[model samples]
Target: MEQRLASPLLQISGLTRHFGGLPALDQVSFQVAEGRVTALIGPNGAGKTTLINCLSGVLEPDSGTIIFQDRDITGLSPHQVARLGIARTFQNLRIFPRMSVLDNVLCGLTVQAGGSLLEALLRTPGLRHRERRLKLTALEALDSFGLGDKAGWPAGALSYGDKKRVEMARAFVSQPVLILLDEPVAGLNPEETAQIAALIRQMRVYGKTMLLVEHDMDLVMGVSDHVVVLDGGCRIAQGPPDEIQVNPLVLEAYLGRMSATA
Candidate 1:
């Protein structure tokens, strides 16, 4: 089924996380609208990745409630969250180094329903059919990211830029309703960053909801439909990209002073 862009699908309320007495996220709240690209932007230590970790179930929050599709999903395990149709890419690459790029992507399709272990051991008709379909889907996902030719190569042998794209393809293979992108464009050159930004925009055209945590201001402003700013573990501003660009508080927190770009 196709999702519409006119409604809110994820609501985060009073989300907070602490690490050894230091508050990484404090009372953070936001709504991710269906079918929109939402970027989470802030300074180096503003809790962006911590918030993402909480959302993707890599870390449990100290206090908060996460509502997705009208259900409270706070504190769910990573596997539980993935089964609920949320996919994520981490700040560090999570690829299987020795595996083929195609196989790395195919791993994401584990969510695709297959028969039980016993049935698979017997090569049941249903499981075979599902596995074949999943392979085709995984290949298509790699091709869409411009990495089809490298599908047979070792994932660890690729350049950093290509590795990032592979990670993205893996997350995208799950076909989730929401994608949590943690620093998708970090440490890339200008050309690489531009390519990724374009891919994100393409995903947006297809109505995939994205919550991206990126340090690249240009990419964030160019690809995001909405921007949320965090400072000292608190949400300081949020709105359309243009509005956030001019927000005084955002300028001060992100750049240490007011600037035209905020």
Candidate 2:
């Protein structure tokens, strides 16, 4: 189990999104505790992806208040949210095909760079020093995921699993306060899933807050400190894995049939 903090790191109240007059997320509310893994799981068309998009600033919620670390961050731009110590990986891998593995990770660290415009323009000693330091840091991040040897290769040249690891390295390099992982194990084999699971545990060990949207129930049950379920864009159930597993509403959401006890 994750060692969650005393107070919520994120508080979302009355979060709603719609398209063409159809609701995608309807009055969703939840609190993600700091230093814990919160799994967001639901059936198909449950708006899990949409919620992640809204949180990461990819899609604005029609109405809601998103409070992160005690500040209202609703409607912030993507870069603005990122600079505030929020980072994410997509359900689909987003990478520059031609960029080297190292470069892909390097791009994420740009937000943490410390060279003033004048120093950069002058190519001062300080600017060069920072660049060298960034390279070393990037290399160290890659090495942690066993990708150091492949850092010179084009990102597109790696297998899908390796590419995901690179994306994870990119997310972790900056040491963000929170990471939103969308379907992190969506298309991997058992071996690859195990690899990612191990890495997720490593992130927890380092005290990272994670909001996960994934379909792998076993993975969610094994790794999540808390699980929140959604159905037709509304939050239906939330608790530890065992409680969620037995919740009649959850079973009905996925099976489309309510139990006699429900």
Candidate 3:
């Protein structure tokens, strides 16, 4: 379990988003503690993806404030959010199929890249130095994810689990303060899921905060310090993993029936 900090690293307040007449996120509020792993688990159509999109600036909330490190970042573009030390992986693999594995991870460092476009075009010494440094860093990240041997291969040629690892390595390559993982283990087999789970814990050890959106209950409960449950675009229950497991509302949301004792 992660130790909670005095102040939250990210705060969402009164966040709401609507699609035409339907609400995707309804007055959602949550606090993500620094250096902790928080799991957002909910049934289908629960607005989890919508929330991620809004936070990452893929979509703007109709009304709300997103405070990161005490700065209001609501509606900032995706690159803007990433520059503020936030990185994320998609529910759908966003890997560049035609690119070499190393190049795919290199894309994540664009936010950190320095030197003017003219310098890059001229292949200045500074630009070349930065490029070499980035490649080494990307290779290290791939090694950490057990993909070093495959770094030269096309990302599309890898197995499904390997592709997921590549995406994750890309997200971590920049060492963001927070990572949002959407359905990280969705299509993995047991061994692959276990590997991802271990990697998640390893990231925590490296002092990374993670907000995970996943349907895998075992993985969620196993690695999360806190869990938030949403249903039909509304937050129903939130607490520590153990408490969330026994939460009546959570059970009802997932099972579509109330507990016998409830």
Candidate 4:
């Protein structure tokens, strides 16, 4: 495999998140390289979600600098960050259950549409053309995720794994430069997990950078080019899979508890 050299797509410096008096994330910092999959792994309650939430503007960090593509976006709103091409899928699936899969994906493209609510309601000529293009794009995204055939189906009718896949399709429909995936393969069977992993690898080929917060060690170790391990809201280790797998701190953080039980 040929390696591509590119600058970091995301940079975090001294990021801290606190819930009242308890700190969930403490000055955590890392960089997500362009066109590469960076895995964020940690034991439960290690603040992975907190960090991601702050990065995605779901939560505001107390103090920190979040730079994307060299622009400071530390306290930007979620909508603001998203408009800058930073997209994310939640740890819990957040699809519109009552909507069709195609419509669910089409929501991602609404940011690019040009029109007021009245124009959209009236189906004006310009808005109609834009809607047609968005639908085509949404369909293409679904096809890429192997869900094109189910485009018209209600999202709630899909299996859990399929819903997860649909969420991924919706996130990518916006053509984001950086995508944060939170436990994307959670609750998936082996086959579904494998498919999701493959899809993640494919994203790299498509030149989309990924920051994956996943607990499945096999998937993280197998597909990630770099991995960051967190424990108790602090970074324990960060390196390639080969190094992360053997780091004593990482092993101690995850496997040490198992050993204590044993």
Candidate 5:
């Protein structure tokens, strides 16, 4: 069955990035439809991470354009991108081990935290009210991710699975329009993988647009409404998951390797 994609929320046209004269992303282009899960899949070194970095403004593209919400955002900074309603999680966990879970989630609110320095210094009534409201919102986010009880615990004290949930809660706390998830299920057990897959679906149900780079074919096929395949830093195939799964290029470049390794 063909998947019906929503209107395009993000458009990448001729996005190229290089490291040391080698193209990490060579003219890659794709559209992420609004309110859908778009999976970017390829073998390692296929520019998946580079594309994600470029979209999230961690690295500027050497050439090409990135359009978000119909705005030209090609070279925006990470904070600028975040303030414009895009949030991302890292391939490697970026949690603050020493900080409390609630504090860690609060970090995401910086994009929405608006106040003058003098107002904060004086702790005005409005500032206090806003702070309280933000804290409540953070607590609600934790509760949604099933970490409400551990909100006061040191982030490092949680188990690996719980830590992953904490990262998810923090990334989503700010309620960004688009979420970039990079290898969201890396190093998880089967149970944890299933949990994360369900969470991904839940996010879509709530109307969050997502673009994820992942190697877990099962999770990708299970949750993705649209799939884009990249190989050697170029887009090779893209479409519904069923079509992408049988694509000759994808089979030769991605799944064939998994079959051989297994």
Candidate 6:
């Protein structure tokens, strides 16, 4: 009999992070397959954010290996990781408050821009061409998220949900291989949440892979291809949403907090 090989787009092993004497993440390990949505769920203080930070290069783990596209990117800087085609949205919106929405999205294209300040100042043909292309691509990204009309609006003036949508647009403009979303629907009303969920499904249709960290069970169950449950800085269970919904460990972790409310 032949053994099948795993084709994971992202893989982690022995991921651990400690703060002073407390462990925020402990021996965490998981694989995110290409072109599928993987949801990371856990209660407060379960290390979900810490794990994402490590993965996105916002925080370095005490020990671990992060392999993406078969490259060892562990300990890379955030910009270095972004250049490697990994983009992330924060739990709190990180948009430029005073910039126009279109300009905010244009920032994602900086890595692809031509030459340098001198070339741009001299109005070189190459720099001009790249700028034109970036603007067009930025418009298309905004259109996909239904924000084309708000291109000139100041990012600070947008509502919470629209700000989140803009952040998603900015992340997508870079054509990332994998996207990490942290509490994307947090503080949104049902209608806005549903809209964001729809946008996520649209990205899946485009074959975009994602790792989502969210507290909304309904959204997680509806969109996730695989669910990884965490508790006290450890992975308790991982499986399809259906299996995760009924897993004893998952149930126990959420029993008191979610069972009564969900």
Per-candidate local distance difference test: 0.86, 0.85, 0.88, 0.85, 0.87, 0.87
Q: Write the per-residue lDDT of candidate 2 for residues 95-153, one digit (tens) a residue.
A: 77788898788777765464333343455676566777778899999999889999999
What does each candidate score in C-alpha RMSD? 4.8, 4.7, 4.1, 3.6, 3.3, 3.6
Relative to the true structure, candidate 1 reaches a TM of 0.90
- What does candidate 6's lDDT look like per residue over 1-262, in tens digits? 1112279899988899998879999998888989999999987778999999999999999998999999999999887888788988999889888889997887776643423334533556765667788889999999999999999999999999999999999889888999999999999999999999999999999999999998888899999998888777888788889988888788888655565556
Stretches of candidate 2 off by over 4 Å are 1-5, 112-129, 255-262
Whole-model lDDT, model 1:
0.86
Best by lDDT: 3
For candidate 1, what's the RMSD? 4.8
Query: What lDDT tens digits, residue by residue, belong to model 4 across residues 1-262?
Result: 1223367888888898889889898888888888889999987788999999998888999988999999999988887888888888888999889889998787767653433334534556776667887889899999999999999999999999999999898788889988899999999999999999999989888888899998788999888999988888888789889988998889989667545544
Off by over 4 Å in 1: 1-6, 112-129, 257-262
| TM-score for predicted model 3 compared with the true structure | 0.91
Please identify which of the two predictions, 2 or 5, would achieve the higher lDDT against the true structure.
5
Best-to-worst lDDT order:
3, 5, 6, 1, 4, 2
- Using TM-score as the yardstick, the better of models 1 and 4 is 4
User: Global lDDT for candidate 3?
Assistant: 0.88
Clashes per candidate, residues 3 or more apart or on different chains = 0, 0, 0, 0, 0, 0
- Give the per-residue lDDT of model 1 (tens digit) for 1-262: 1223355799898999999899999999888998989999988888999999899888999998999998899999877788888989989888888988987787777642422334533556765667787889989999999999999999999999999999999899879989999999898899999999999999999899999998777899999988988888998888889888888888788878324334
Q: What is the TM-score of each candidate against the true structure?
A: 0.90, 0.89, 0.91, 0.91, 0.91, 0.91
After aligning candidate 4 to the native by TM-score, how far in Å is the CA of 136 from where it should be?
0.6
Clashing pairs in 4: none
Reference-based lDDT, residue 92, model 2: 93
List clashing residue pairs in candidate 5: none
